[model samples]
Target: MKDLLIRSATEADFNAMWDIFHTHVAEGETYAFEPGISREEGYDYWFAPRASTFVAVQTLAPHDRRGRERVLGMCKLQPNQVGRGAHVANASYMVSPYAQGVGIGHMLGEHSIGEARRLGYLAMQFNYVVSTNEVAIHLWKRLGFAIVGTLPKAYRHRRLGYVDAYVMYRLLDDPARWPLPEPAPEEDD
Candidate 1:
């Protein structure tokens, strides 16, 4: 992980990125994209005009393909809406299954937040986070996002039938001011 490099992605990096993207979507567990999304559709969705794409690469890999680094994870930042809603940011991330639990997801998340703030976003929002994806929910919460809304039975989980999805939000300008949860009551023993 010491050799990891995160930077804005170029078209040359798409080949490696596609692998991670396809695998995660194919699993149908975390993201909402169709499992069989074609490469072209993926390209448009990922690199839309308003989106800024970033990738984490294993810089020390010797088998670089066509001068492209091996992408371990990817994130794209964009406006949550258009015109009147453009001040809010939206982002999505994916990490290689082989690289999970090594802090790749955390790094991508933090980077995206900084990038979003740098771009002048008032806040960031995740529109549809699968409730069953506990790891993602925990990570988002740890990163200062709060579950602002829950859409019951919004996501049709592959194995869990119909599951809920969460809408998480984080205010970038002064995260420290965000409200905290009330602590549970303590009982005298």
Candidate 2:
């Protein structure tokens, strides 16, 4: 892995964070966010008071004269739901397009899992993963998530039309004691 540092996002990181988020939103393929979303709306969604936002910064080598670290990615972690469902965590990750395929997503995913566990969440769930996003689907599955359910034609892909979305989840605590219900067996004809 590169000399990457993952830390809680601060006020100084908002512009960089927004840049990465806006870029991805403009792509209109991964997240459900609308394109041309305003900075205020982006702030509210990514840096909400209740959510824990993080930034991944790549440190410059000591010999580099520029001596500046760059933000390569960002992620937000929050409750999947409110009240009785608060125990399960949810997260969204975005990597700078220039930094894609460099393992930053894996770092962010692993960091979020630990952070979620530290926050007392018993599990982590991604509610609307676009089924056509094979890279993410593979990554999440490699990171321990499972396709617990699929919402058919849930995502309106900008180019692929309506595509199925997956509900990916992983237990942070004891799996046998996880509170969610198991699927009923299919009846034989």
Candidate 3:
């Protein structure tokens, strides 16, 4: 495990954040964005004015005086719908390929839940989770999200052809009663 720092993203972090976003979009296996999505489009989607975005960084070392760090992951939380349905939050997450499987995604998931609560959201919903993305599906389920609905052949995966997508939901306003797994210990590499 490595030392992970999760913080609200600043304007200065857009370049690195866009790199991760573009990488995932280009992969075309999970996210639904166009493979050749432009930086401006990526910025508009991930850094929406009303959305709260965050970044996860891995610090160089405890004793490093320069405070050097590497961006490993990022996420955005915002209203799933406007006006009437604003109580439910929507979110998207991306972990850099270099940091995949290192628990950075899990950290971002947990941090986003807390942030959503702090922002007064009653629940959180993921609109288009690619069904083939088993890792993310399992992670969201473990975090208390349920597959509320599925759209058959909703995603045109670059390699896998058409695939189903899931709409996952979780009531964050009352986690105490939710059947969520015990939170994992923070990673410390």
lDDT of 3 by residue, 20-86 (tens): 8888888899998888788888888878999999999888776898887778899999999998688
Note the residue pairs that clash in candidate 2. Answer: none
Per-candidate count of clashing residue pairs (backbone under 3 Å):
0, 0, 4
Off by over 4 Å in 2: 61-67, 175-189
For all predicted structures, in order, the TM-scores are: 0.87, 0.88, 0.89
Task: Report the lDDT tens digits of candidate 1 across residue range 1-189.
Answer: 767889999898888888889998988888888898999988887799999999999866556655445789999999999986787999999999989999999999999999998998879999999999999999999999999999999997777888999999998987565345468799899
Tens digits of per-residue lDDT for model 2 on 99-133? 99989999999999999999989999999999998
Which of the two candidates, 1 or 3, achieves a greater lDDT against the reference? 3
Query: Best candidate, TM-score-wise?
Result: 3
Q: In candidate 1, residue 27 scores what lDDT?
A: 85
Write down the worst ten-residue block by lDDT for model 2.
175-184
Error of 3 at 2 (Å): 2.6
Q: Output the lDDT of residue 58, model 3.
A: 80
Cα lDDT computed for each candidate against the true fold: 0.89, 0.91, 0.90
Of 1 and 2, the candidate ahead on lDDT is 2
